[model samples]
Target: RSPSLNLSFLYFCQLMATRGRGRGRVGRGGRAGRGGRGGDQQPDPLNQQQPPIFQQPPPHQHPPVFQQPPPNQGQNHVQIMGQFRVLSPPTFTGADGPQAVDDWFMNLERIFEVLNYSDQEKIVCSRFQMIGDAGRWWSDVWRLKTTAERDAMTWEQMKLLISERYYPYHFREQMERQFYALQQGNLSVEEYEREFTRLSHFAPHMVDTDFKKSRRFLNGLQKDLRFVLSSHGYLTYAETILRAQQIAASQRLELDAAQQTVAQPRMIQPVSVQPPSFQPVQVQPAVYQQSSAQPSGSGGKRNFEGKKKKNQQNKKGGNGGRGDRQPAQQTPRARPP
Candidate 1:
């Protein structure tokens, strides 16, 4: 061989050795791969093409896992007008003392707006008047208007201030009750009338006011009363009224039946008339003999006695003038011949 031929043979032998080693490694390991050092095992194209776990969302991160708030969470801490109204006071029992006027401070705060209390001075003055605290009402108003005063008071203190000034126990109870009813439904003219009738008994003073003003007051009172009552769970007057209506309906049905019974009359019919039958009357023998003897020649009669005797004997012993038809006349005939 020449020099170029020897070089070609050396390269071919090295390539063959490398190929044989790769095949030996694959056969022993049961895998097709290069025997080259430093991990000549390349990534499988299928495995490399898959998306990463971190790159995609987990199954648990679903829409149904979202959270929501409880309904009554914010309801307990509402404010009326500018004043904060706490969670409504618990229900009243005959056991508890009367609710003080300050209990209604929240309600009074709303009333203040109606009276045009915008400034701090006006508001403090108005607060006294709303509670009807008598001397304190005037004193608070004077202090609030003329001087500055800060009173850190609880809702109870506010109610007490109101109770001290204006309403008696009865009046306070009335206000509370009316407010309760108003919350359940919008009042009608009829309901207003009924409320008015009730108030007439306890607060005749309100009755004397003009119908329009009374109506406005009643309407406002109704709204307030109902809200408070509903919160406290004391407003069951609706059920009472429904029961009364049912009783009245039954009574009305009974009354109508009674009236109908009284108004109608029964009728009576008259009996038919029947005529009496005629029967022949017999004459006494004495009267007959006297008449027969006198009738002979007394009244221009010729042989009357003899003819009468013959006729009588003929009727007594045998057939008379129409004796042939006598069988048809079972009794003596009333008609004359």
Candidate 2:
């Protein structure tokens, strides 16, 4: 009830308050709180100059913004759209010969277009790494090594270098000579014309006109077929070519027929049936001799009358002088005659 009792009560209350404060600062396992740990912990030598590790780094004046790259800047910061679909890169196998240039260049263009890298000269040069001749050609001839150098070079410069090594302009000259010099040879008309058309692509100026085309075709045609084609007065290359093909086909058919005949063994031809020969009739000359021996009617009558008269004369003379004169007269008359 006195001042002393009030002092005791106040002391107990302060102790109870102290205990509650301790419980608040300490964790459930009785581990020291963050403030206590700080007091107990040693100072880190590494963080002596810097702020505590727990302290957050100051916020940027603007937000922690990544600096966006400008348009057509480095590829690293570029955000490519998914809509730009890319196709597979084209490959060259080197089987197409010098004409490989067409495929290689065209394929490279297609790849570039698909990849949206039409302006990337470096990308184009880099693609040559896929070529079969890269080691031999792109390395040795051009003396190019680094990617930066290749990327810097223009495509034309690279193309000329390639052409110089593998296929030169002189190849075109050779093709020119070959085109004019091409004769039909043993090739069929259609085959020869096809070759002519393909070769003409190499030398378009040579046969640019239809007349030139026809002339070139006629010139290359076989000697046997040319004259016949020319006589037809063919005006266009198409007409000449068509006629030549027809002629060649006919000639080929004839040749096949002749070949077939020659290849077969020769057989003896059958003899034709003939009519029987007629026999000659025999005639005798004796028939005409017998007919002449037969006397005419008038001649026979005269002979009869003469015989009758001779008989009468003999009868009359017989009576008179027959006896004596008959023998002597017959003998003397015969001697006188």
Candidate 3:
């Protein structure tokens, strides 16, 4: 019993020592944590609790400070497919021109509606012209003119300007090759130029330049429609216009005929006829007629005849004598057809 009690006492002492060591370690750890978290101080390296520096935000992560732009910032060249191109026509001073040359073609497209060009020829041609001319006009400022100068330009000059300046770069490049080929005696400039000009006329962008001149050109070409048919392409826009116009005229004639048919007066028919009325004829009573014939009974013929003469006289006077000659009531009658 004595040895067992001694062993129990030894176990209690060991347990108390273990508890004291654990409390001392915990208190030291708490002091270290509080010291590392002190205000206005960084944590000690050994005691640092946050994620590593690499995991934290970089010093340059903040946005750049705001600054005033330079005076001409608005006119800066806009980037296009890695190339910076002028944003607007240098002549234009307002907000920079639309982002793409397609905007310029939009004006031509709008005009296409008014010109009644529904086929793809004008659309494709005008777009090519718009894209081509932007590059050309960008390189050459003199090509654009004041409104007055544009208005004063002759139709021939306008057509030449459009073909020379506004045609698509690829198409013009091909034309240049042919022009050089013609120069080398491989082809004739007149024939090739005529072909190129006729073909280029269908591009959508070409319509933006001198549309009135284009109409005139088409009209002139119509006189020599045989040449248009013989062209290498065998596709003439002049022919398209002629066809569209024929359709419009035919439609107009049809509409006019329809209007005439609508405007003609309509004939109305009578549904029924009214028959003539038959009225009853009132005849005098036999007794009244006999009395009138005799005229002799009121004690003597002279007295009765005197009364009859008086009644006759009253009726002739338009009085219809008061006591004995009331007017008869007549029935209503239908009108004759």
CA lDDT scores, all candidates in order: 0.47, 0.67, 0.45
Model 1 TM-score (2 dp): 0.24
Candidate 2: the clashing residue pairs are none
Q: How accurate is candidate 3 locally (lDDT)?
A: 0.45
Regions of candidate 2 where Cα sits further than 4 Å from its true position: 1-90, 93-99, 102-130, 135-158, 259-337
The residue-level lDDT of candidate 1 at 220 comes to 43
Best by lDDT: 2
TM-score of each: 0.24, 0.41, 0.17
**How does model 2 score by TM-score?**
0.41
Model 3, total clashes: 12
lDDT of 3 by residue, 1-337 (tens): 6876777677657655644222212234345233233233442333436443335567979867899867562233121111211222122211233323223444444554554443433422332343343545533533466757644654345334544544446755654454332221232323433554544444435444555434433443333332443343333455544543454456569989999999998988967988979999999867544454544455577777788998888877775455456778998898999
lDDT by residue (1-337, candidate 2, tens digit) is 9876787677657655644322223556765575464335444333356443244557765556798766774352233322222344455544457767655666666655666553354344344434665445555645545767655667666666666765568877788788978999999888998899867867889888999889988989999999888888756988898888889889989999999999999798989989899999898666544454338688788878887887778777775634224454444345654
- Model 1, span 1-337: residue lDDT tens: 9876687677567655644444323444565456543345434333345443335567779667567766562342222323422322222112223443334444555655564443443334434333223444445544664222333443445444445544467765676466434422455434654764544444445445455333433344345443333354322335333433444456569989999999978766876778877898997777454554444446637566667877776676655553334566368669986
